[model samples]
Target: MSEAESELVQSITTPLRLEYQYTAGVASTRFLRGMADGKILGQRCPQCEKVYVPPRGSCARCGVATDLEVQVPGTGTITTFCVVRIPSDSLDIDPPFVAAHILLDGADIPFFALIQECHFDEVRMGMRVEAVWVDAEDLGPTFESIRYFRPIDEPDAPFESYKEHL
Candidate 1:
């Protein structure tokens, strides 16, 4: 094979190595408890009336301490997505998956998650999606508490549905 072809093959076949560790805080404990019950929790900003999922202890937008704990709807719309042709060592999923930015209903910002049980090409912006909760017994104080999101059978959401979320 030519040098260019050989380089391309090597690049495609080589796996990238990544390593990292995360330590949770006290606020995270409560968030995990909510997830164990199949609830999506968020911290609400009293000043701006915005709710953040995967709840942060403070409001970054308003730079204020937000203490109100609210339950956000699991149903949401896909704001954006990319097909994951490459896999990462930290990921628990298979390759060629779809990663998406979803704006849960009643949330102020979009959060990242995986989309599965559907075709990659078929996943699109503004598509309605719902949380696929993990098995109750398997729930934890981490993102793993909730499984991936799946495309809902509902009709395609209109452009106005998730445009601002982008």
Candidate 2:
């Protein structure tokens, strides 16, 4: 290296640190408030007639502005899932759990959440599941208000029901 470049590289000794704070926008704020009240809110696209859980302010498909909010049932059908067998301290779940894509009743886009309250091997592509909320006392305006999804006491949804989601 050139002498000037070598000296400049050696002179760098401090590390950089910065703090970041985020403010949830209008659509997200409404969704979070609904979560705090044990509700799943979705926004309908007037043009496409599709509903989105955790709604964005605009439609991803038609690019139309989303303004109509709707409540969706917490129960949903599992579209697809993966069995997590690796041990990881960073994750809140134990090994051998499932991470699944679920389509809530009345919502079009599938939502991603954990599948618990049953053996990991029991999770099927079209299994019906329902949200398991944290106790009302511990609820907050955050996604953590919903702990996970558990298998409902119903038969698995027919393949055609969730085929489009997959």
Candidate 3:
């Protein structure tokens, strides 16, 4: 085929789909209970005053066992983001989405999630975002319980807001 035709064909074709699955021990029943209640729960690292979402049973940084359960706020600032032009098998969202690292208010570390309800170009690295909660009836013991992050109406925060988390 001509070079132009080959390029056109490649662009038009979709990639193959691959599938896999694995079985592991069930996650903690307590963690699931937290998500169902519209709460972002984390395990605390007293040594560093750091909180971990998907609450860890132990602190990876300080190498100390953690048992405290902390509730992280839903509001956060975008530390960084990438305009996703390509869809991946693991992601449920459509293409041209924004994947961002959000530093939850009062949390030491940032959590990765999608930024929706705004144009990709309008999303900035330090934009303010708030969690759009899933329907109360739809709440579950999973991250999906919180649907996605949406732009906040508040004034843009200074770079200092989430700079260190990055």
User: Judged by lDDT, which candidate is best?
Assistant: 2
lDDT of 3 at 153: 90
Best by TM-score: 2
lDDT of 2 by residue, 1-166 (tens): 9887777544656889898898988899999999999998889999998998989988998999889999999999999999989989789777988999999988888988999989988899889999999999988899889999999999899999878878
- What is the C-alpha local distance difference test score of candidate 3? 0.81
Q: Count the backbone clashes (under 3 Å) in each candidate.
A: 0, 0, 0
lDDT of 1 by residue, 22-97 (tens): 6666556667878877788888888987888877788887898878898988899999999999878888778889
Per-residue CA lDDT of model 3 for 27-128, tens digit only, reads 345566788998877777878878776655667889986677888789888999899999788877889998899988777778889899999989997788
TM-scores for the candidates: 0.81, 0.87, 0.78
Candidate 1, which segments miss by more than 4 Å at Cα? 1-23
What's model 1's TM-score? 0.81
lDDT winner, 2 or 3: 2
Q: Tell me model 2's lDDT, rounded to 2 decimals.
A: 0.91
Candidate 2: list runs displaced more than 4 Å.
Answer: 1-19
